[model samples]
Target chain A: MKLSTITKTILTTASLLCVNQFSAAALIPTHDSLVTVPVVSHQVERTSVHFSQPIAASQQLSSAIDSYTGISDEYWIEVSGKQLNQGIDLDVNHPQALIRLSAKQTKGAWLPDDHAIDPQDLSLFKNQRSIANAFSQKVTREQLATASIFPNSSAVKIAKKAGVGKFKLKVSKTLKSNQRYLINVKEKGSAYQQVLFSERQSYLAGQTITVRAAINYRERPLKNTKHMAFIKSPTGISQAIDYQTEQGKIRLAIPNDLPATKPGQLYELHISSQGRDGSSSIKRNGKVAFAVAQPTARMTGNVTANNQSAQIGLEVASEGRYEVSGIVFGYNKNKVLMPIMLSASAHYLQAGIQQVTLNFDPEILKSSSLIGPYQLRSLKLTDQSRMAVLHRNHVKQSNAITQLNK
Target chain B: MKKIVLSIMLCSVLLATPAMATQGLAFIHGTGNQTDAYSDYWTGSFVNSVRQGLNDPNKYTVINCDFDQFMWDSQAAGCLANQLTSFITNQNITELVLLTHSNGGNIVRWVLSNPTYDSRYPNIISKVSKVIAIAPSSLGTPLADAVNQGSVFETSLGWLLGYGSDAVSQQQVSWMNYYNQNWLHGTSGRPSLPVIFKTIVGSDVESAFWDGDSYCAGYQYQVALETTQNWLDSCSDGFLNCSSQTGAGTQWFIDKQRTRDSEPLSHQQSRRDCFNLDLIIKNDI
Candidate 1:
């Protein structure tokens, strides 16, 4: 078709703009830019009896310790009630109460003559009426020692099976001079609440990190709960993030514009939930830490393996030290993948394609009965200087190794 | 002639055997950017007492680094790794025992846990025999959260506390919990650390004004700790909760379990020679 000079000029400019847009789009790096070699099996053997069962990737991967689980089920109550002549009044609200008492000598006062108070000299009162058998069990000096000071700091657990109510603790005997006491009460048997991060342990920049909160009451998800979430940077800056309820779980996503973190520094996602179940108030706080890194480098998907070692190629965007680590897996007589050993190495490199070597020890191979045609599993490439994980692959089959000279 | 042959054989045998380990100690200070940790953070008395267990007292070094930054910051863990690597190389130390207090434990744990973070980390981990963490804020403390919350709590106590550093923020209970579950090791379900990390937990703070024991460490610090303990659990050393001190590594002993006279070690006293704490560490090394 014929066109005028002005129309041709406009068409030319539009075509150039389209080309520029395509170029820019291609330059932006994403997770797909990472070079990953899928697992490839060269030989297979079948056995009637399975010696080892396949392990799930979740179990095989390293995970964080869940030591603080059930922490949400406990809450601390401040001892700010009425002060009595000997002790103070406790307003317990949970089924179980752990009361701890410690004596702190005030300023300009000398140590008390008696360091400890006898438990037998303690009394419990409800509505000004003494409960004769309030004490669940007899507490000894050794149990008190576990709290702070032996014979000085004492703790007792009161089992109030009757449910939440107010109670008071009083000392029958008067304390000596300069021994002012402080009390702490912790209530247990609250709602069950926990927050967990996704299975992915590390994330690159421009990626979203997910956190899910499970708040349960009476074996069911708590309703009408208000959830708040925030991301605390390594530098202590807190930024609130938005969350949503998805599939009956409170899910929060980390923002895309997360600032780069220093080596060994982690960003924390703190989630707090508050709700009520039938006149009882419940609150829980949970947090999960994760590492975020700039995509400084990635594997090139080129691996050269020899009998003694395997060298992996990498394409770097920044000048820094890089580390490559992976577990070497060998096939047994039944063609089952068994982990042989883990090897890692690091080196400084310029912004270009580079190589790293993973040396396999001969003695380790001999003892494990490992041969060539091995697979590198859980292969990871980390930018040590930038402190970012750039690439990770589930499995990468090496170029073949049949035997070693040694 | 037979005696002469035996003597030569014995000399050869002795020469073939490797030399004994040259032991060294490094005293790592807690949060601030210390320039002279020997005199400022850990007094000469405490350092000297602990080093006496070594064959050569000169083999010890007091690390001075900007620990107020995050554990992985260049001035924090990086500075620590540099000084530790230098110590191991200069002294030809075959074995190293690190004595860290408070947040210092987290910094060292970073180097041990993420060995690939720096080129010097693997080397430092190899030469280290053990770490003795005293009153370590391993799981962190609620006091940090209270300070960072920065309202009435900060206005009333933040100035006196003066610990609003990055390290303190990182030690907020939830932040430390994140690190424990994700990055750090030696907790309940995490993988065991390559080096044995033994913790000495300070269970309580005693700052009676008239008592002589209260003045062993800085009385003002103990007083501040006593006030700050309101944000912590009952089992606290006026600074860190007992759970935090025993959060990461294996619990070596609590304050009353090992300290002389069964005296409870306050947060400040844990770094000093109060109640024979220095002697207890000395005997341990």
Candidate 2:
């Protein structure tokens, strides 16, 4: 759906209100009197993207080992796959592995005791070279039964220098005659780069999202890297997303014509990066999920406050249940604005302008010794039916309420 | 005159103390749309054993909702809210403890984190005293990724291993990271939740034919879990990595640390009455 001119006009009016009232003073008058306090409403611009697909049920796998056949001798299991600059760094990604070989009984039962493969019979190799000291000394029969394979410090050091490459686990010993075993490999640790999105969790369909990537556990930029990115829908459909990079930041716009997502499902942006730091190769994968919302309502920038409550105006586009939530900031005994209480209320409204009330507790005000010239901060309106965040205002100041009786 | 005086004294003693808080329990299943979770997901024995801690054992409900949808979906959290609210209101429960397994933790966490999401959510949050999550997939699992990967080799071989559902996709390693950072709470540097959320981590999977312990929750299930463990971290419960279980909430204890005789709890066993897990939870509540 395209952005309408009427929506633009509403957004412009809201923007003007923000510019005029955001800097208003939160000072309370020494004497109580009727006054006009500007309520700053930071209204979000709404788009016309609505998703209307029925939610799909989660799939369940019948079995996880339907493809593997019982093996009685040596076997090779690929630890990492060779893809386009996507080879994993063994040291950074998966440094240690627990390999267990369970004996398969004729009656389809798995026996941990009968298979007689020792820890010395297992070896890890990159391009078929034996890595010494790969297993720690704790791999007794008891440890093997539990599949606990701890990596030695020397082995970890050796893995750090192995760079980014495909790894394979090799079982050297043969099983007893007429016996078959099943192998299970488990690995851990990822020292890859960290990727994060800039604050907001939901965005308009046409809005841009910002992402930043840095080295593992450090804020340093991952420099001189090549990135491939894609956006995956809830239905497992993937589309390549074009991104612009500047100073280690990536920006991608949510396409207006993107397919509708199922209810409560989010779109994921996946990024795969590959680079070289000196002679060592680095590969990392990161993703972030966000909801793209269609605007169904906007705030009217009008508020009325009394001794006990405040009513905020909203302009609705359709009939549904909408919710308004905000934090109330009142002046303390020191005359500084501090958060006093948070209040939220929702109501069903027709397609027109309506108001929702935030009733402040008198006990709360009395206990905090709060005085007026109160302000509402972090005001938000959500379309509960659509499950979308419709609008947000950072701050809104209210008129002084006199005689908040205990 | 003596009999009347003794009766009056007994009545006075009863009225002196306030009424005890009505404690309630709920069992939330994971990853599927359950209609009869009491029998299908968590058997009757497990639920009954855990609910023995309640002041009124009858004050518990085994929630049967569609958890296969995303955590925030109407069928998921919306249904949960409805049932829990009914349970609280009908039973006059003042304090409620939630027992969640796997993705059930995420659904409950969604309600706690976003109190304003639904009109029913705030009330539910206020009533929840604590959440005892067992083998929670708080962080997504690598096994999910491998299953959803649907590599050409597996697809061509006609053994896709797993059904690629929205719930499975959501639990992928990267997807859970995204949800934790942006939507959920109680992770490191994220906002703390309104209620106490503690996790029980499952550390290993054992399927020995000779060992009776391996057959407690179904021997075949343990075999499948052992095979899937290959896709997880060494510190995994066959289905989820140990880090994933301890990802969102406070770590209550690992499997061997608290289970009967220090036996490890597999992913499936965590929901069953195996290894005296139910007794442990009963005492805690």
Candidate 3:
């Protein structure tokens, strides 16, 4: 059944309360049973057992176990359908097989691959996904449920029935209230399942707040496979929660609206996934930091001219930040110009290159309120799109500039 | 004593002379051919073409030095550095032709800039007759970030670095750091492109260049993740960027299919296209 807003808010509140919980099981959680996902279909050629799982944000995950296979196969398909049908005995050579939280959403992470990262490193939503992508390969879901943070602790370990796979975090004592929890993810070879991704969210016992985490691609919404915990103390100390919005954009959303939330606002950004592109974030020290959604205005546009010979233009390829200038003249635009090397002129797009470094040029094409758009040639046209983009990307003052006398 | 000294000087002169021989020509390597001799097929092909174009291999010893494709095999980068340092000292090296692949541009840049390499063979850098780069990593490639993740991810990300060398597995941190730290131009190091030297073909980015930072464009919100516009603006091919693509010469980015216009070529095809596009640069600029 669909959940009502009231229920969601309550659920959100409950999930918020779950942070600040810590478990002290120095032993890597060990599970009771085992589960192996088999390669489906009669086209069974060979399979590499994957032990995978999701690592919640603010959690650390890793593994030392090497590679092991269930059965020996005569041949292995190298790429999708292309195979090494030589009946060459295939073996799991290294300790590299495991399922992972691929992505919190259908979309992938900012970087192509992911890894187990420090919390501070997870501040960038993409970095969070990087850490998750790095760990999901070592452990699987089944392995986590039966495991434990402490020998008897359920925080790190998974229970037989993780309680309806409830979307909530279980906290511990080590964490102080209102502090953010940076989690990690890792894999366990000998487990109930082929792979398992896990997390351990814990914050202090001080001030606290709650928020929902989501993953997005373009504009489509995706699920948050994991949740981490943290605390924001009333002592003007707090962290931010990173999130993947409904649009697949990995965002570092800070609770700018919360009553007590401020720069010192502590937050734990919860992230999870089957491993494709699960999101996460970290701080400057390489620790995972929660992210707050920040939407800033970015300008995009072009520059153009009317004359036919030396047509020049510009475009802003960045956010609302820059300085632009060039000369047009007092009364009317008049002058001979040469092909400006974009890179040479910090403002220009340099030869055939674009993006790397930037420099805004003073208005090279002068305007005098007496002319049409600048022209590349007698017949050739020019605009920011076709011309060298730079200057005011979205905004240009005038188009009347004199063409260089060829 | 005078007789002995004269005899020694005469012997030295004799040893330095080659009978009825022409000057040694130059050989250039494609980008990132540093994995090893076998892994760099492009370099081998470049060697063959150079040999064929010149009609002599002995006169033009194409130094297939290690040019790590930015995978950060310190060993590979080091090996190339050491060997080239030696060649610069040992070989008479008549005319030098800097034929590089992707970041090979940076490799050559390093060679010419280093006093040990360039000073010993000042003529080599000066003789830099032509720079025929094959999809050189003039600009970095963002895709390279994946390569740094090591083995586990590589097992998952296969088709990534089409030119898979040991460097691909070498973490992404160093490569990024190297570009940010070292990549730059010198005053009199690399010879100016007197002749119309050219950069090869391919497309790299199309989707959302500027992703992590993006805005709505069409039905699906556009991403700054890796948009062509963004790449042209900030991101790079596995490693470098567009602004970095230019040098002290005439430059061009070819996309005959226009696919590169919208979607630039991934670092791999950018190389293969080098051969097909060879016809253009062979004679014309």
What are the lDDT figures for the candidates, one per model? Answer: 0.63, 0.60, 0.28
> Candidate 2: where are CA atoms >4 Å away?
A1-187, A190-200, A214-223, A277-282, A329-340, A363-375, A393-406, B89-94, B112-129, B138-163, B172-258, B261-264
lDDT of 1 by residue, A1-406 (tens): 1111111111121222234333311112343444332221221111111011122222233322222332344332223112423456565556656565544433345445564556676787777787776766444443433222122345566756534555768777666544455454545444454444444446655555555565677468777776666777765567777767665354555577666554556777666666666765665555566666667777665565555565676777766677776665666677666566556666766676787675555455656654444555555666656555665543322221211221
- A122-236 per-residue lDDT for model 2 (tens digits): 5666776766765542233433222211111001122344443455444455544444433333333444444544444466556677666444424345467776667777655
* Number of the top-ranking candidate, with TM-score as the measure: 2
What is the TM-score of model 2 when looking only at chain B? 0.93
In model 2, the clashing pairs are A40-A396, A42-A393, A59-B165
List the candidate numbers ranked by lDDT, top first: 1, 2, 3
lDDT (10s digit) by residue, model 2, range B140-256: 876555443311111111112122456666787666765665456676544456678999999998989999999988886676667556556688898898988999879999989
Computed on C-alphas against the true complex, the DockQ of each candidate is 0.07, 0.16, 0.04
For model 3, what is the C-alpha lDDT against the true structure?
Answer: 0.28
Pairs clashing within candidate 1: A372-A401
Is candidate 2 or 3 superior in TM-score? 2
Give the per-residue lDDT of model 3 (tens digit) for A226-318. 333222322223334544443222333234453332221223232322211232221100012221211111112122222211112223222
